[model samples]
Target: MLHNRVPHILKRLAAIVLLGLACVAAVHAQDVLRVSAIPDEAPTELQRKFAPLGKYLEKATGMKVKFVPVTDYAAVVESLATGKIDMAWLGGFTYVQSKLRTNGATIPIVQRQEDATFTSKFITANPKIKALTDLKGHTFVFGAPSSTSGHLMPRYFLLRAGIDPDRDFRTVAYSGAHDATAAFVQSGRADAGVLNASVWDKLVEQHKVDPDKVRVFAVTPPFYDYNWTVRGGLDPALRKTLTDAFLRLDPRNPEQKQILALQRTVKYIPTQPENYAGIEAAARTAGLIK
Candidate 1:
């Protein structure tokens, strides 16, 4: 009877052990990398741009990669703070908001080479608006209100030029995206508009907006703008893996080159919170932050 009881006990223990092992495998299977970006472009375009990069990230990290889309810039910041997402693509001003909202828990890990000196272009279809000063008494449009290149820095520069957008322009509008800002001006909805140079260059390169129909009104000087920020408590090892993957995107390789072109970057480099100091300062000065 004792020997029979021992075999039955052994069988029960083995079943428990197998259940634990299966649970571990299930947890590992659920370890997916969640990523998101600010809605700075049309949803479809952003999806198209991120497709190759997502595939590349999954292969590089040995984890399933998922792209979470947000409706607005603030949604990206909120998602990062609430831990609904693990990482995000954010503009400089949006990064500042996230850092503050998370009590400095968000980390900007990598930025494009061109991000070090990002610029905003003020474009217009109206021939009368040739310069910043000329925008007075005319309807003007800006990209998202929280945009570094499209709004905050552009507004800061406008104040520096003694042109208050709110007071100087007859009407001010938000186009919500760089491409839309160009369209607002081209369709005679607004006399002038501003957007990131990246999207502006893309529009020109793609002939999406005729150069003659919509021309640059003014170009802002260089400033730090966009970066890929991860949540504060992200695993260090995984963070390093993410950093290394972006750094490894070499333009010399054709496959990587296509990814870079889609991202509009020549290469990616390590970045830190300090790179966004001036952006924060500019936002504060522009009254976007209190």
Candidate 2:
């Protein structure tokens, strides 16, 4: 009787182990879509805006969608490279760095189209300063030295105006985020700062910024900025599915429309890695990375 009972116990244990493995495999096979946002901007704001995007994606792909929140711009790159997240809405600069890290870590589906492509504001205080040339020898603030809108483009415009940011500015400081840079300027900590015009507009619309204290001191030539980037190495089919859903999302869809508004995007246009090569070149020229 004891021998018979021992065999029965072993058989039950083996069956249980096999069942667990099957369950694990089932979970692994389930499509789990993860997404995130660039830093400095509020993740919650993105979640609110992109919530419909996620729902649209889920409905389109028939997969479970997840949104992962990140604090800063670089984190989005790091997360996507490690496969910790499947997709992200990233800054152009961060997207370039992500490619460098994972070799082919990202695939961009859509890029935000602002009203103007050739000019973005460089906000400042000093009523005496009327143009980019007037910024010479004055202190300035730029967001994350790696920031595309906050630093790279702003620096490029400054250089175009014949000002070497590293040399002409009495001092240069990194406030780490556009909003922080705005705060620094608004509080008189810096003479001026670089920020996304959309972010500035939002803050102004919300009455968080006082237009009297800070003004657009200069505007940089418009260049591509933000996009929704899916991690590389994803199944080509899944990537295609997501890319299509994102691009096809209707602007009239109230949920997607609101999110697009926050992102300053009117539509999700198809883009490729090549679309951002100019941004990569700009980063290299600035020496932010090799």
Candidate 3:
């Protein structure tokens, strides 16, 4: 009888252990704040840029912050769509694509102050390519096909200027990244190329690319651009905490200043889906999204 009671006690202890494990598992499920950005810039540069921000987010959200790097623009969108990432830095076109992909389940929470009126630049080493019209019969490269500054808005402007990229250019190529677009034109891989003005400015600032070698020939009109967006089904409280953290990134603080400078923004501001209406319209007009 004592042996039988011992067996019952052992079964009871196992059940208690299993229940404790389940509770710990449930608590850990959302303990990590996994964030990623579109591969707009080089991977090394992106990592350098996100390092400070990741630390800042860890303090802000009280969760372990991790930067999940993606390989391309579409991967960012897909990651957000499938809940693979909690948040992402998305260009306007990519944001629209993600929102559409998830059936309007993503939220554009905040953006760099300049994103409200973002612009793109067309660059070239060929002196002959002086204007949008001069691009005729020349090889042209664009950033990722899903890029707002690199492709969609640039194409929209080119079309508006009566120069169809597909028909007018001798060749059309996708460099897949802004830095690569500048390199393509500077190295003569393409006669001309276009990239976001932010990247072009950064490259010039960093002396990474010679401005004289790959100079801007044209600039697209301003449009809505990049934003920090959260995936759908995120806990409303966590979403608010994240949004508040971004909104409250005070540049007066040294740590926050580093984060802002690395992000290439003076300050973060509240953003809404409505701000990107023009972007959605542009993607539709450019036939990038149905």
Largest lDDT belongs to which candidate?
1
Off by over 4 Å in 3: 1-19
Ranking by lDDT: 1, 3, 2
Worst 10 residues of 1 by lDDT: 25-34
Score every model by TM-score.
0.91, 0.86, 0.94
Candidate 2 error regions (>4 Å): 1-30, 115-119
For candidate 3, write residues 56-92 as lDDT tens digits: 8899899999899998888898999889999999998
Which candidate gets the maximum TM-score versus the true structure?
3
Q: Name model 1 segments beyond 4 Å from true.
A: 1-26
Q: lDDT scores for all predictions? A: 0.93, 0.79, 0.92
**N/CA/C clash count, model 1:** 0
Give per-residue CA lDDT, model 2, range 106-189, as digits (tens): 787766555225345788778988887777888989988668888887887677667898999899999987888889899989
Question: Deviation in angstroms for 242 in model 2?
Answer: 1.3
